[model samples]
Target: MKSVIFSFLLILALPLSMNGNDFKGIKRITANESQNESNSWINFVKLFELSEIPEKSLTQIACDSKYWLWINEKLVVFEGQLKRGPTPNDTYYDEVDIASYLKLGKNKIAILVWYFGKDGFSHKSSGQAGLVFKNDVLHINSDNTWLSRLNKAFEYTSRDYPNYRLSESNVRFDARKESFDWILLEDNLRGFGRAKVLGDAESSPWNKLVKRPIPLWKNSGLKEYKNKINFPFVSKGDTLILTLPYNAQITPYFKIRSDAGKVIDIRTDNYRIGNTLSVRAEYVTSSGLQEYESLGWMNGHQVRYYFPEGVEIMDVKYRETGYDTEFTGSFTCNDAFFNRLWDKALRTLYVTMRDTYMDCPDRERAQWWGDLVNESGEAFYALSPSAASLTQKGMLELINWQRSDGTIYSPVPGMYTSELPGQMLASIGYYGFWNYYMNTGDKETVEKVYNGVKKYLSVWETDEKGILVHREGDWYWGDWGTNIDKQGIFNAFYYLALKGFKNMSELLGYNGEVKKTQEKMDAFKKAFNAQLWKNGEYRSETYTGETDDRTQALAVVAGLADEAKFPEILQKLKTQKFASPYLEKYVLEALFIMGYEEYGLQRMKERYSEMINDPARTTLYELWNIGSGSVNHAWSGGGLTILSQYVCGVYPVEAAWKTIRIRPQMGSLTYAATENTTVNGKFSVEINKSNGKYRIHTLLPQESNAIVMIPVSYKKINLNNHLIWNGKEKRNQWSEYLGIDNGYHTFKIKSGNWNFVAE
Candidate 1:
């Protein structure tokens, strides 16, 4: 009782700053007096005297759109804050630990806030240029005490502007109008004034506050290019071209000596990706030598700088940055095509992650939830556990944007609130929310969005025969290719959403809800067969086009079609090539799920041969043919998940991988090895067949269990050296030999390093 009392007292004594909303009396402050428009930049500086540095000093910062921080004139945060609106009216704040950058005595802090004044598909306009900050330990709060100014040097570029899908605009910086040394000290404070306090933290516009769920970006500080363009090269009226090794999200930097007002236009080859305007910048020279790194990021393989004939380039480089994660997952096999395909898919997945799981970084950097479903699944198999937070953020955002009438929309945090019925169904279905919970074991997140999921699913209804009343909500988009078969595909997706909700209900111990959900699923399945399944394929009466591989694939994956239909569907998939790359993943997965491992691999190779064989391609395209489409699409990287989950066969049998299954389906390959980081720990497996013997090695994390299955072709089985199976009976020791299922010998194993050989 005494200890409990002491713990309660300790909690009461803890600093209020522990919470992101604990801004005390801190106010939203702004510097813009002139009419603030789109693409506005404001610089702020604050000086404080600290007798001695504290052990730890964390700061809470809230801004309208985005910010960059500097402590003692050293770059601390490259970009901070998630795009606002956890809900329609809420805002997000960032908590950054500034202890390492702090020092004793007089210290200076600088911030550059870029307010995206216009609303786009990904950001909501706050209608005011404001910032709120608090650091109780450091005795700092954003108020009238801070000095700020509207930067006149930063202006909208006269060049092409980005389309409405994007929130960012092309920036043009006039070096003569501003002083770069203002960050160092108050060397030039001509236009500076005290910051105007707007109101408290709970003011209008930004009514609610939430902590940022994902980590700040990982900044790869200025790196020189490997493709040498020989520094100090003088230009002669032509554009200077420097190519990065591959497609990347980067900020271009260059230092050059040129005459005043000579404009140097900088952009990437993909400034107009998918034939749509993307982000780029321009640098107007001051007088003599000047250095500038454009804050706006561009994506492409090559960087081009158009100069006016007389500029002498001293050095050129760029900084690469992306979502904070490490490539802990890996896949390799004897086949080079599959290896290269997996590599390209993994690269594409990483670039598509930033503010949200983007459809494509070069095009609209919007969170199309259909794209997010595939991206989240791929993250579990390709990246470390840190990537899971991004998935959580996306799930929350998708649900938070739910409308009152039980409808949901995507490409959110901004203006595009139109519902894409098929995509919305996929977003809340088994592959999106349930897959995330299975891999992450985040029941809290599940609980947070469960009501929203139930609400969205409630909007969907069925006719008298129990077939879903096809909803063409705002957009009836099914896939990017021909022969959509919308009616059949929507039925399959609705069933999938019902199935996922039932599982979630079961996990949450909602017994009544589970039973209710299961009844709906069963009815839907029976009605779907009666209405859509005919002539060995599940094509609806409404669909008159060719049999859609995507619809057939979804029916198989969702278990809506019977086992009798598998052979016919297999034949159709073998001959048809109508599904886009987005739906192709499900087709490949369904083939694997049906035990057509060889055919699954063959289809993968055939479908992705062009992307794999291209010498210049480092990422997958939005479509299979790759004509006038985005080069880096997250939905197209579903192969990354297929390669790791099916080819390597390492998947969670239970939530958070408390139980895992190692069922290697290395079709024709003699050797295959793969590893991926899970919530439990790192799980790896290597399999090879040589000299009439199959060797299997696995590393399972502690406190977990594994179910290992080896092909029945190898009659004699040995574990570590002891003969566990002698072609007839089994001798059990550390492993319990479960009865064979589906032409393989099964064993239940505890977590540890295990090696098995079957000869």
Candidate 2:
């Protein structure tokens, strides 16, 4: 089986731009007297006066006191909690999109924010309210208010609402004494009432709200420039320049025809500080335009440009943009330590796998093992490094806690009650260790861990049914605390284990053991195929005889399908009409492996879109449903991996180490870019595209044979001194063979020559 080498850095530089409109500013408000609050409340009411009534989308109204987001006085979101902080339970927050709720003009928005008590576990402490646009643009208002009377009422009643508790009946008569204190922060935008504690002097009710300036696009006076300009040709010693709209901040990008319309340059400098109208240029041709000579200028709203002599222009565009406030979080010594420590851990795992197994012990064995393992591990670790580390530590603790009989129980108390499948667990560890070794090529560590892994596997053998008997049943435990029959994933792992055993036996010069292991592997594969595959598709179980479970999808993704039947099986799976929230990820993986990239990307986009829109989701979750807490599962991390593999098309080919084939299926994407992607060890790749051309920049990790495949119409491959193969019969089988080396290597490719490296 061919292993794909992925590096941690490879994913960081993905060019999927986040919509910049989501961030909005917050203003603080103070509460003094009810009448003063009423004046402040008028300003909040202005929001509705400016728009038509009955907003269609939901608006979130979060406040310390009794607050309601009113659509023409009809409360859409009401949170009457006299508490301090955000609700610990995930359900308290409301995210409503009110696009349909608003008319052309004059809409009323009102809020009554009050301070209850010291910021506690309620929604009051960090009081915040906002409106979200269809584009995810957010406008945040005041966060917290402190009113003494409200606190008394809240104390009298142990419920979020001061007036009533839905679960409990008796209303405190003193709750009426909780006169609402409104401290209004006045600003041109909006103002809501606020409250103060008894010990502190009642702050004056005044408007302190600061309205954010409307975006430049909303200004009708601004000239709209959306035309596409292209340069016919780019020759040596030639420079090309184009004029663009100049603002305080300008985003300039160009499409170069040389790489099949790939984006050659993007200027994001000075974007965050403020908008600036400026012209910047990079040399398109060395002879005509010097690097410094290709420059432009931003003169107010008009952009002027000058290109060094001889350079031809392809296409130019610009946009007005802004930046979000920088986030500040804690940093610790452990952060730096862990950065190095994880790499070291990866190296250790690699060395252990190499010395124990792998095809080549002395020549490139550890390197291969380390490369594969580190890449896979890095993919998951990059998403949530903390979680990855915890998982590693947990697995290690489990390993150490194994009993003398080789039975390993869960380390987390009450998490599991049964012993682990001794053989299965050993196989998983070995596989992980092997991947680490393939990524780093650490032989010593591989040798150290080899005996233990081998001994563990050797304890089990094939039974009359040809299954690896005595192995633990269902090691994953159904991922939801239930253990059914031995699962397909576990069975696949068993096959991999047998394969690992055979490799180890040969690597250690144990020829007799090797023969036996190979025989066992063959028998296992045959029995597994016979039992699990029926009607031309893989099945999830032998007992129920069902083939529609998600596990079967995983099997396909893991490359367990027979090559001849792969296409048909994949088509069937796609047309099965099975749509479950839990099975989307598995289906996506299977589709991606089957080369259904377009479908896979659509599925991924739908999932992420749902995640972004779901009010229940503040951050990405493990599953789509509410009341589910597997929010940190490694399986969810697979989305990023799929993005890298399918969308970006940065695949690993063992024969070619230097070059990666680019097969982008991102539909309707006018432009795209990715950053900081690491391939082989030190190599990094940056890809940018606009129109149809792709500009690919690669950094080599070590000296190795590299092959890049570009689309058939592009002939720049020859210009770049790269090989061009136009085999009609095997147009999709282009490949590169990188020689041996392990440092950072770099190269460039264009879309037109993509077919040269397809396979």
Candidate 3:
């Protein structure tokens, strides 16, 4: 039986050379003759024989939506292709290396394409269906020679589709209509037709093509449900419940035997998180035993399966997948609550990452710039260096989608194009674009985006008093909750924006811009303090609402407030509680920046108690109260940044971590440790504050330097057990000591492991 199958595969295959290098003039092919419909699926297959597999084979593949490729029944690329419109009217392509997957002879390539033929908040529809494949080394190019057909088995579920905010629709697959043997390239593909050829790379609808900016997703193959093994034989009208180890972005898979036409429904616990439409799938079984898995992804802790009256299930599982990134940075401390919060934040950040840095995996996978600003900053201290590429991609998208009038809106490459002034300001401000550059040292990106940032900032006009005349964009969103001091928040953000732009201008040698932005910054600061500073709290004269903690937090964060007023400002933050989880981060950061490290740590724990302590949740929630909001929001994980950078007390002073500051703010905690990776290398530190003494250990990366600071209260300090400081005077081996700064004794050390003790 095996020999007969092998002989049949050889006869239906075509022999091709492994030495073609031409990529031009390859046409886009589709099985559909007329215009393609929304949520369409097409299957393409090619068979070729190779005398010997080459050492290196690379292929470039482009498609309208997304495609999954299989080389000789082995999955090579899963869900390959980025959303359309890097800029308007252009598409992105994937270049995959297939060298290892090719065999010596009788190799087959099968591709399944899922074309999202409609527009949404994160995707732009091309209104056409096509696939183009070119292998310069193996000489395999897709054209009319490839056998193709529309997969009729794949269709929309009978239920309503996901909300218009989502590009993906509810998927339904009928096993009876699909022949699983097609992947083996069986004899006589009767219904398959010659692919209809479209024009070359420069063709319309998909005008210009750019390479995919990020790496393909990391697939965790198939992982069984950890919470349950006895998946009850769900009969018609019965449901099966299973749970994952935690919340994750995953596709569902199961095998079962059922009578024909028995339908089963699959969804996750977060199918309707935030009370918004997510995604689900339906599978119609054929007679006898069969297996099926979905390609669309859904995220949650629990998986639910609803069976109509007459189906028998055998096995069930899921395949977890996410953006290609690793946790090269981590933080842990003496408190279990803080440690648990850090772990949850890390999970939230990872699950929300994919084609973009989404606010959440469900509801809408839109790249809201405000969320991206926080997400990008968190990535620097949590994920590997490759994760920075996503931030770069989002930064470019924001500027590339700029309107002629210098107005920039986010959640782009989709239908909704409204500019939220605060979000837009944050996108280009000190902690947004400038912070990304400071962490990654990508000078080219700063140069490319400077002009756009300048143009957008130029649109604002100030009143005679140098106060910004609040100009509302399409949306005037200050924050989520009420009692928002919009005028005060706008001025603070503008100052930060000017500061970031001025720094960029200096970096790019645009001295004229530097001078202009400095003047603007000076004017704004002068006006803000002169007009908004009343009772030691920053609020506009025209506002008559309650005190705004968010504005005060931004004032401290943007350096618009003086240290002399921190006493009163801190009092206001203590009494006011209007900031949402998103804005609450700024408030906590302000506390850390103001030398109130203990209070900062306490506030973070108190504000995140519900999310951190919930036995059912493994990730943070979109709101502090966790009411009707997304349970997994990356923006809410700002505590991760606070813990690593403040409590662990490790942050970069120079771009790409060339120079770092290790000032451990242990607060009331007795011990803390962290390992953070940068473009240069990994930096790890551990600090123990017990027995009325401080023991500090640090391992600095090569080509990097650290300025370590210990409290001035430590009367005597020793480095490597050698006396370095004796409170009043420096000892003989005190070369590493720098003078005191802001109540701490500082030292500069080079690239090696160093240990210090202070009493």
Candidate 4:
């Protein structure tokens, strides 16, 4: 027997500022009013040379919804998602350090502000389109004093998509209508005048914006993709087809010189583009060279430019999807396709992860709860250490938007918060909040939202069958594929929520309330199975006989399924109908929990064949094909989560990572390796199952307690040729649940590695 092992070093923590509550004196400024509504796109530039680069410089910025603020020529920040303020009238601003992007002298400051008067998920303008900036070192503000013109190349799109009403902007650029050197110091400002300055934030329509305990959006210094594609001039017969090897949200800029008014239409398969003001294939050639820099964002896999028999594009510098923070996690295996799939899933997380967990960066840049639960919610634990707290901020915002009656909405602070009965406001959103709680043991968060959780639970009463019912015409968005199965799915999610609430109740010392919840849960579980379970699987509706894979997935995770029925439910999912990538995210997770690791891995390979085999795809798509309008959807990145929970099997046993569960189930692969960093510390694992025996090498940060569960009977196993009786073998859904007894085997042994050779 060994002693308790504690070897990890304490990680240094960095403090971050939250949303702003005070902005009394800063004036809101906009483009000169004479030009207001004159063009959809406004280009503003101010040239200033620094005598000597300052030791430090910070800039304050605010815009309608979308703005590209560049310090010098380098693209500094392409902030797309912003809330008005925490409240109804607050305007939001960002403070960024510009010292690194600036030189000693001769620097250019440029801004391309896109005013989508027609509200979209990412933006809802207060009618007046504007930009504001102020920096003591390099004094600046968004006012009429800056040179500006409405560039006609960027045109507002059809905005035809459903969930987000995606602004499918068309780009038809005529260089002749362009502003030359718009981002250069040499651009003439003689025509520039006073910008129609709005009153300071306090007096403006957007008076106060959310000042979070932790800001959601931070500059990760987005880096260009390793592979950059440049194409030569081409005409109508030969349209330039440019596709990314993966999915990302990027600002695609190009240089072109064409005869005045030569039409070129740009077409895109992705639902959202960085710049919607311009046509993707429509290029109106100006007499001279005009550089087109899209302030808007485009997220997709393939884009093309069609020249009208003559218009020519000089060259295009296309950047891949943008992401913040540094990637600290890694995953690899013996299978090459699996590795590629892992890479694509990781990219999906990166592209869809902005200020919050976007459902899909390509279309709706809104932070969705169920989507977060499936994808960005867990991936945050891996790559986004700096922004992971953003998830908590998002959770608070959901509760912040909770109505007095306890009903919640989908997109927070939108034109209509109570659009439909989405799963987010009901039960799924809290499921994600629990995940956040487990990863980062923040009691304040639980305390902050406890009342809201209670109120929300009591908002809707259960039917005679004990299923939570929604209002007539209420849209139940459990999973896109769970059509009309709201009853079954919602209850499953409610059960999951109750379990989390019960855990929180104990943690927060609300025993009396938890007991009532437990009683209700006990009753609901019995009623749900009786009402919904039919044909061996749960029906989505009471008498409609509808069934979806998501219903079963949620049932398994939510504890609504009977222990005896696990085998039948697991078999049904293997041969079920298809679902969107977002829905599949949960389905895969359910399989992992049931110890169907091999089937899940095999299903992932067969389902994600396109993403892995297609050379055009650089990231995972939201659907099997580009038809769904999103190539890189956050919800589709379930593989990364699966790898973490099932393959690497390192999960939090308590709030934060005080104690963890290490249950590695290497499916078909002979070897699996992964590393992740949590608030607790870094955890790394490597496993090799060769010659019918297993060898596991593990690393855990300081004083961490763990329940390391693996297969193999205790009687037949020997640790380094020594018989060990510390772990108890139990049979559950898995072949064997190796109960990890922290009291026994400790990492106090040298190297913290162990071997279990078959005796």
Clash pairs, candidate 1, are: none
Evaluate residue 363 in candidate 4 and report its C-alpha lDDT on the 0 to 100 scale: 55
TM accuracy, model 4? 0.82
- Candidate 3's residue-wise lDDT over 444-515, tens digit each? 778778889999998888999988987989998988888999888888888888999999999999999899
Higher-scoring candidate on TM-score, 1 or 2: 1
How high is the CA lDDT of each candidate model? 0.85, 0.35, 0.85, 0.61
- Candidate with maximal TM-score: 1
Residue 113, candidate 1: alpha-carbon lDDT:
88
Candidate 1 Cα misplacement greater than 4 A, ranges: 1-19, 32-34, 186-188
Point out where model 2 deviates above 4 Å: 1-398, 409-431, 459-461, 468-476, 480-486, 500-516, 575-587, 606-609, 615-618, 651-682, 687-695, 702-759
Poorest stretch of ten by lDDT in candidate 1: 8-17
> What is the alpha-carbon lDDT for the whole of candidate 4?
0.61
Better of 1 and 4 by TM-score: 1
**What's each prediction's TM-score?**
0.96, 0.42, 0.95, 0.82
Per-prediction tally of clashes = 0, 120, 2, 57
**Residue lDDT tens for model 4, 496-543:** 777777777877999898898789889988888887887798885543
Model 3 residue pairs with clashes: 236-308, 236-309
